[model samples]
Target: MTGTAPNRPEPPLIAEPLTLPGCLKIFPKVHRDERGRLVKTVHHETYSRYGLISSFREQFYSFSRRGVLRGLHVQLPPAEQHKLVACLQGEVLDVILDLRTDSPTYGQHELVPLDGERGAMVYMPPGIAHGFYACDDSLLLYHVTTQHAPAQDAGIHWNSVGISWPDSQPVLSERDRTFPSLAEFASPFRFHPEGSPL
Candidate 1:
């Protein structure tokens, strides 16, 4: 565990909605002490109030070096995921693309800067393509609503969505390089307007 678990749960932190539909940016309150700092990563009740009612079934974290870009990824249908992602060790330029066919913001993308020192996190709804650029040696913590399904794994090619990533060539896996371009993708997600359940 990075920060010691509190003896008693802390109060819920509020989140701000981003321009991208269904995406939210959260700044968790950090309590500092002589020992270090204590961060409350998730408060089920706080997230529930924000309509993120799904119970996370899995939690994972990843490490990336500067310039590494990891996605624009998604899973089809029954395997699609809703995620809460946080920076636990460094900073990243996180990006999201709306892939919902009925969304008015379909094809639009948003960029968010997350810093571990600030305890920042983002909530991504299923059907959006997500990726990040490591601004430093960074660690990301992820909480998701679904389990992994290799067969359902998919993505939009990182460079094809018009994101203005830093000019150095991004370090990418062969899989990320091979995903279809946004223009070439046939979206499978349908948009549920605000106030409707996803």
Candidate 2:
């Protein structure tokens, strides 16, 4: 069983499967000594053995001041994206919504606390909508298989679903506020149990 979950105590990097069918919670190797710390965020071969091997075409950062709320967003097909996300500074209450109609967890959302000190990351396949709250001044790093496509950019309103975000009045942008609610938009992605990459 190469893609084992529940965290292996001996491996330097681990991917724990979440409730969502194709999502993963990744723990990277961290070295700590008198010299402080070093976090190794990714390694293709190790991730591959865990059923996660992405081309990762682009890398970007999202910096949020304390109390900022971002996303609940996704890209449409033809420009869909596979994402690897990590909060490298501060911490965040990260959430993801599964939109694949056939998935066991469709329409359900799961959350995990991504702390800078913990060095854990999240991997989301194409149809998943993602969002997070900056518990403190946080910096999130993202790796995606596709470049940003404005025309294909899409999202569900952060408050449309039943996510228990930590902030009652977090900062928001006009664009994020305008996305359709979960009940309003029709999903264009599907789940393939035989393992379509996303």
Question: Against the true structure, whose lDDT is highest?
Answer: 2
Clashing pairs in 2: 72-130
CA lDDT, candidate 2, residue 37: 82
lDDT (Cα atoms) of all candidates against the true structure: 0.86, 0.88
lDDT of 2: 0.88
True lDDT of residue 107, candidate 1: 94
- State the lDDT at 161 in candidate 2: 84
Candidate 1: tens digits of C-alpha lDDT, residues 55-92? 98899999999889999888888898888889988899
Q: What does candidate 2's lDDT look like per residue over 15-70, in tens digits? A: 87888887889998889899978887778778778777567889999999999999
Off by over 4 Å in 1: 1-11, 194-198
